[model samples]
Target chain A: MNTWNVAKLVAAKDLRIEARSRVITNQVLPFAAIAMVMFAFALDNENDALLVQVAPGLIWLATLFSLLILVQRSFAIETADGAIDALRVAGIDPGGIFLGKAAALAAQLVALETILIGAAVLLYHTEIRLGGVVLLVTTVLAATCGLAFVGTLYGGLAAGIKGRETLLPLLLLPVVAPVLIGATRALEAAFGTGKAVLADGWPWLGLLITFAAAFGVVGVLAFGPLLDE
Target chain B: METIVDLRDVVAVLGQFPALAGASLTVLRGEIVLLQGPNGAGKTSLLRVCAGLLPVVRGHAVVLGHDLTVDRSGVRAKVGLLGHTNGLYPELSVRDNVQFWGTTVGASSGEIDAALDRLGLSLRLADVQVGRLSAGQKRRTALACLVARRAVLWLLDEPHAGLDAEGRDELDAVLRQAAASGATVLVASHELERAGALAHRTVQVIAGQVHEVEQ
Candidate 1:
């Protein structure tokens, strides 16, 4: 019917499928948890000061890797049974489909971030502060949106190709460099020992929001043509 | 006659190869036409072109009153294509898969059940995941989805490939019923004798060109 309603339907389908399969929770979650632990080992767990210093960058890196998996799985699920063809001809607007996919991916990212952040705090012994919580949430949301937008676009771009697993990160990493940097810097400003980068995380948050808006709009507009054979 | 599909010298390229090299065909409303050809003869490509999945880079191609050159998305909602892949989610139940397609086209819940029942998928199998079902059952589930959409144009590619005798008979009845209900049907199959039984006319596709086959 309506665009928003259609998007909800698509998102609901993906979430329902994920809930049944538990691929992300059972497989990817453990992989990210182990990755975070490895990062701690890499930084030398005895040195809490250095661990805190690099936790922000490691968190973003873990999220990026997890995102690559999530995006690839999202497209792979559709590749089965020629579902992509069904989707193209199903009468739903391509933009609606793109929004639905991006939303589902964003939801998965939220889960991954929560788990990875929890691991980072416990393993890395990072300090927690109640201040700047709003900015932290804003930064995460903006960055998530940006990643999901580009992920969905490139995921669609790489569908049906044999080398998509290797191709997606190649297509996505360069475009998403700004997101990783902006998000990490914002987190560092919020949680790092260097408390005087700027008054607030506003500047980095602004960068994240701009990236989100630009890529989000582009993804919606380009999804139809990208999926067309 | 209301022509649902009209392709004139349409060219579709897949990588460096031209799948539809100057192919042309027309299908009217409520007609069941069989498309027969060898492997790589472009039967699948022609069906794809009709469904607006393949872009026509040259000449004229139209479906459901929308020009493919201008925008193919306009015709997608009104067309249902059942390709080689069943297009069902392996993790999702039969009912869920059917509902996904149904909801995509805005079909009512009642209509969804009726479509499933028409394809002989009982209530028991409806809740079972598609991955657990046999190939025939999966095909039936996909056919249920196509029926649920109630689309005006139906493009079936090798629809009877995996089905047993009973399932084949059921599909034949479904095709006849669909045409009787005024939906255009185009089926591509290598099973010439069986496919011919369901067609009012047959068209041969050779190297992406369409020619009428004498009955």
Candidate 2:
């Protein structure tokens, strides 16, 4: 009945399952790193300036694709054995379930993004300036929250449907376009990729905050009905 | 006797298919009622409706003093529905699965242990992942979870399907014990000979309508 308590329980359950399964470490993370490598090779150049200029968008792009895999894996666990129905019948607050799932996803995304950022610096010769560190952290956190909330909401929407594997990306990609654009632009400003300043990136952070807040509220309200349907 | 379930002309649909076409049934407290019907005769739908998992499109329905048509969610915590799937997380251990469901109702660790023990999951077996267990063991684990929830209403669909002879007898005993403790049970089972012996009454569901079997 207590929403916070339920959220904690559900989040812990999901994290524990993930820890035991090792799927992210064994599969998804490597896939993301490999995607970064593939992106570097696709440009077909040893020119460090070009790779550095494009690294921000490339990192976020890898994160987005990895997010699709994470969301699918998250819901797959629930639908595999009707555990979602059991959760509904158990009378756990759906809002709490939404928060819990989103939180776990945000945590995973943070880890994935951290690795991807490091990959960018290593592979693309991108510079992380001392002045931009604060804005970069803020951008990653806010963007992760927005992506997690939207991913959980859309994942629940597409759950239990036949061919949801194909449907989820179609439904999710359009909704997340703003996030991709916002995060990339913010990161570009933070990295000073083109002639941008840290002040310019702060405004994009505002957009990311609003996006996260808006989707967070909508996910909590709509998740229950979506699960029921 | 107190009425635990009351339905009149309840109509429920699954994407345009009227799964419960104006079906009516009444069940009292502490009664074990068997629902007999062929496949797709609305038996599962009826149980789902009682468990508050299905919406009543038209008609009046109430379970545990909660008017389902008004608010079906209120009855969910007090009822347990065991459908075809065991609803167990394959990656979780037996104890973890039972504990997770049990904690929803605030059941303590001791109660979880007792439920696992009641279902013959020893300490060794309780530590094993449910995915590795046999079909019969998974069913038992599911039953253990239901017991741990301390549900007032039991909605079991083909509960005895995957059990061996001994497991089947054990399941029947568990149901009888639950009934003795004043819990109402509605079981949709094809094994009439076994379930009929355990039920106090039997009702036939034909074409989404209920007919008394006159036990």
Which candidate's lDDT is highest?
Answer: 2
Q: Give the per-residue lDDT digits (tens) of candidate 1, residues B30-108.
A: 9999999999999999988888888888989988899998887788888889999998899999999999999887889
TM-score of chain B of each: 0.98, 0.98
- Writing each residue's lDDT as its tens digit, candidate 1 over A38-62 gives 8887888555888888888898899
RMSD (CA, Å), candidate 1 to true, equals 1.5
- Please give each candidate's TM-score: 0.96, 0.98
What DockQ results do all the predictions give, each relative to the true complex? 0.85, 0.79
For candidate 2, the per-residue lDDT at A66 reads 96
Give the DockQ (C-alpha) for candidate 1: 0.85
How does candidate 1 fare on TM-score? Answer: 0.96
Model 1 misplaced regions, further than 4 Å? A196-198
lDDT of 1: 0.88
**lDDT of residue A168 for candidate 1:** 92
Candidate 2 CAPRI grade = medium
- lDDT (Cα, tens digit) per residue for candidate 2, span A79-149: 98888888889877899999999999999999999999999999998899999999999999999999999
* Ten-residue region with minimum lDDT total, candidate 1 chain A: A192-201
